[model samples]
Target: MPPTDGPYDGPPAGDRVLALDLGTSSARALVLSADDASPVPGALARHKIAPTYGTGGSATIDLHAYVEGLLGCLDELQHNGHLDGITAIVLSSQWHSIVALDNDGGALTPLITWADTRSVEPRLDPAFDEHAFHARTGAWLHRLYWPRRIPWLLSEVSAVSFAGLPDLVIERLTGDRVTSVSIASGTGSLDLATGEYDAEALAIAGVKPDRLPAIVPSGWTGVLAASYARRWPGLVGVPVHPPTGDGAASNVGSGGYDESTAAVTVGTSAAVRVVHPIDQAPELPWELWRYRVDDQRAVTGMAFSAAGNLHAWLTNVLQLDEAHQEPTDVEIGSSRVIAIPFQAGTRPPETVPGGSGVYFGLSFDDDAADLLAASLQGASLEIDRGLRMLDTLFGRELEVVLGGGGIDASAWWRRCLTATFARPTDVCAEAEVGARGAAAVALGLAPVPGGEHLKPAAPEVERIELLRPRYTILRDLAVQAAQELTRYTSG
Candidate 1:
């Protein structure tokens, strides 16, 4: 197939790339130009396509729901004539989800997502040695990721055989089973040292050698389905260049791609990421992820499943029990309650669910609203714990480049983070950075004006809040609580 060409250098004004972000709660698409650092909301588009969650570790969504939502929105946008100069399409998908399909392009199984914990065993497969697996894949093992679920699909659905998740999605769209290095690295199968599927991991899963998608550079070209594009009206021939996972893209979008920068994103999950020497592949307790959108550079990341979601629980508590229609900072110190944030699977050693919030201290003098405020304080404190572990992983306190759904709005939360981190948090004003970064990936590849190219706008600091530790005792207690939780689980 001939390469789809537009701006491989830098693009002129109005030449656009549409970046798609496939997330847990919704799907968003943004059209970006190499011309601007700040986002024009008018150029962005979004849809609320919710995935159905099963309580029994089977978090799945209809493959059609995502496709329909994407095309429908694009169709509306194009009908409104917004894609005039759009040149390419790039995407970032949530990590660890699996979409199973048969040979004829039919979805044979649900999208067993990162959230699903079913089909996993308590112990590592006799075939999988944890140390050797880590040496090969640089990923921590858990039931939530592809390492376990792919095997489950093979054994349980004996009647229908399909390749891994990305393979099926790419195959469905482009008639080829291809995956980019960025997404593949997030799965438990890829060998970190070699950047390919770990032979030992694949063998245990009973997967065919050809079943996996061929890994390629994130920006490599592949044919997108004209049929779906026609359904989307003006989307015909939209170039599909893959972007790294949302976590990785957010880092790039916020200028955290290299070692000089680091970030803490508070979203449905809280994550601390840093760029570190890849060859070392330090055997730290935190996750070690690859950051290469191309072969140029790589980074390591640590994911905190409880980051932003912890705040959500606090909000619910405030709204329901405390009678406070809105949450505030002053309520935090007066509240004085601590919360345990174990909503999702712990990032490493164990990825099983069952860690829900537990209140540690409370008195009759304190109202439910007060406890709610204290818990939020404690959650920010937990962010400190995660960041410290991240710091230890990199062997230094990293520079903070912060952004996410949580701090994007909610003034109270922003104040909380500023108060917690002692350092001014750099919140990127560009709202949907994952998609915007993906679009920048496209712009990086597009041709430049005057035969010269453009650069991804270096993330600028919108605002900074210095969250000096007002109560060291409070933060210390929270750290001790996290340590206790860690000890309990390790034992």
Candidate 2:
């Protein structure tokens, strides 16, 4: 059980909204002002969760333990009196996770997260038109979504229904087995046009419509289930809003709510997203995905499998000391090493089948710090690529807002990203942007202002630009190497 903290001060209890953030590694509960969606002082609780990893690229969480951790957050909040005067409960959860459910709604399998890569490529049928699928569903025939994962799970276990983590949590809390459009869109099975599950994707996943949770509009609300109502009497009648994908919520939380602004989030993974009204959204790009903020708006972006996780792996592998672990001011492109920072596999537009991390141009003089610096540069370059794609789609430069724990903790990383993008970026200072975003959605508020501003020096920006061509060449070579290696290994 994680500890709970604060009931300090701020808005009146009646004017606060409770936001629950279900992240990849932890669950958090925070109270926010209903007026502006800012977090209430001293009203927060958190619990960490550890996912089980296997040698074969399997990543799973015990469904019971995961849910219990979330419930524990609520327990601590209620015990500390942080639940009082809450108007509604809103959730922000990671996207692209699923679990099997028995007929009675009990979990039949462990929660399979987006990080899991056991469902390999070639799982889809050869006849499936991936491009058409991407255009219709706003997703790819990748292993991260239900199209591949559902069939993979069915080969080993029997299930009557399928649901993502948020759907399951909603069922546990509100006794409503429903998934919001925002959450459903991440499943690679939803038809963006119809705002419902796609029949073709369902056929690919080998599941019928009846086996999935009912799709609901974002901001859909329900009261707590009888058991939970009794456990926390104060929350009994409080409406619980179904979960929104944390990526979309983070954009709103960080003040990137429209087409003119782009949100770049670097957590366990990294992505660049922009929200646009449904009617105004451009044609779906094959390299990116489009998910809903709600029924009225859509978020379009490309996700990279590497980011903070790649940094963590480099630090662990190099055994860097504390000082070296904290990135500092390094001359742009000084490391003289090119890194394909795919400690995890690739994401869309560059989905190399058996991709692994590669360090090109390593020399004997390069130390742990040099390798770490090069890896960070590599990750920044990837994000910059995504941002450029988005800028092209929008046909103009978009204001960039940076959020997530990775950016909040490191000024050096922030500088690297700003230089990479060669633009002035706003750093969202709020430590829990996902939770704040959920509260914002619930309260129908605009983005809150006030965070550090970063403007890149021309010298640094020019230096980074010089390195892009070399990085691109090395990246292509690394992808080709991985493809050849995959073919040889399988044969």
Candidate 3:
């Protein structure tokens, strides 16, 4: 479609829009010059997100700490010259995190991170069924996201109000208690049919309709209030907009927004969201989310949560030997230990959640490096499975554009991903697609679609090792085990 908004570097206002990317790891800002909607001259600011990883039980983020981190980044921009011409900000974050607030807009509970998958399915008074809920909202009835946590809070805590991470923060920043359709669409509560809150979802989540913010399309133009200006001295009545989902922005950053194009994202989790014709909502083996890119288009996404957890577990936690170095694939290949790699709960209790690295080929000679390499290999294989599911569900070959943490480090894993996928993968120049995607929303720019715009990303510079599809038989055996494991563990 046509450009929704102009590149707004004002003579009175300056020509750049300040796009803030609120992410799980960090809060970053990109000042896009209005003259051409390009990155302006100066320090693009960022602050590392405060870590709130809970080991005792309920994993979450410190809402206060996160907000402070966000401010810290904005302060950095203000301290530098970047905030002068900046007008608007667009936000993006990991899906399914829950943060409850009281009527006064103060956070009431710890922001439940996306990784919080405790046996915490609080009951819905309306008694919604998983399949029925999934069909209506196009969300898997799993414990990983908002559908479970909202009900848990309403039943457990009196007078507790809640929304996903993006909504709560955006409300605080803009003084407008509103959410974007693109942001809300990823949650299980939205009615994909109408792009509004579903009556059934409200009933199930025990949320009052008025408590939730109004949902607007991404890239909408609205002014910032003076109170916010006082809170954030840099807020000068500039227009605020929606960058939408982190994955959606990555599509734009990598140019995966077209009807036929799709992005295969391997972030903390993995997913493939293809923007397709809304008139046809085809059946999908993984998931089908309604995206608000334009007015009519919907993006169906298939997600896998355990993409990088395997590598994290092995490299960081499961330390190999005295050298303290991560292991290589060849070292891992000589060993015979097979890990299932389902540390995180899957989308559903079906063939999802392919858990613990099954020791099918373990040997007495297995070393730490060997085991570590095997773990990475297992993760790559599962990612490949997710890709195959996307192809099967979409009934089209997706030109996979890879981004996020999973595809970045572990040179062995990157090449292994290529080989296991049995397809040529395009790694982005910068791996922070979530931030870049959100920034582009404020810039009114599209990711040069079909991976065509990515600058000559030199081959093997990032060290891509393509693993041919030799382990297809082994993965087939693992799927049966995965299905069985899901049934046993889904309680």
lDDT of each: 0.60, 0.83, 0.62
Q: Rank by TM-score, highest first.
A: 2, 1, 3
Overall local distance difference test of candidate 2: 0.83
Residue 376 displacement in candidate 2 (angstroms):
1.2
Ordered by lDDT, highest first, the candidates read 2, 3, 1
In model 1, where do residues sit more than 4 Å from their true spots? 1-14, 36-38, 122-128, 159-169, 232-234, 276-292, 317-326, 329-334, 445-491
Please provide, for model 1 over 1-491, each residue's C-alpha lDDT reduced to its tens digit, 9 standing for 90 to 100: 43333325444666676667777777776667646433545866677855676666567777777766766666666766777676666777777777666765577786666767677553445565676666567665566556676777766664244444445555666676677677777777777666677786676555754766678764466656766655554556656675567776766666566665566677777666765455664564534444444444455666667756666666675566334523653533344455555555456653334455556567787765566565556566656666666677667666676677775655565556555655555666655667765565545532111111112121211111112243345435544566677679769
Alpha-carbon runs more than 4 Å astray in model 3: 1-15, 32-42, 50-57, 118-132, 228-235, 286-295, 318-336, 349-359, 449-491
Q: After superposition, how far is residue 161 of candidate 1 from its true place, in Å?
A: 5.1
> Which residues of candidate 2, in runs, are more than 4 Å off?
1-14, 120-127, 353-355
Q: Give the local distance difference test score of model 3.
A: 0.62
User: Which residue pairs collide in model 2, if any?
Assistant: none
| Cα-based TM-score, every candidate | 0.82, 0.94, 0.81
- Assess candidate 1 and give its lDDT: 0.60
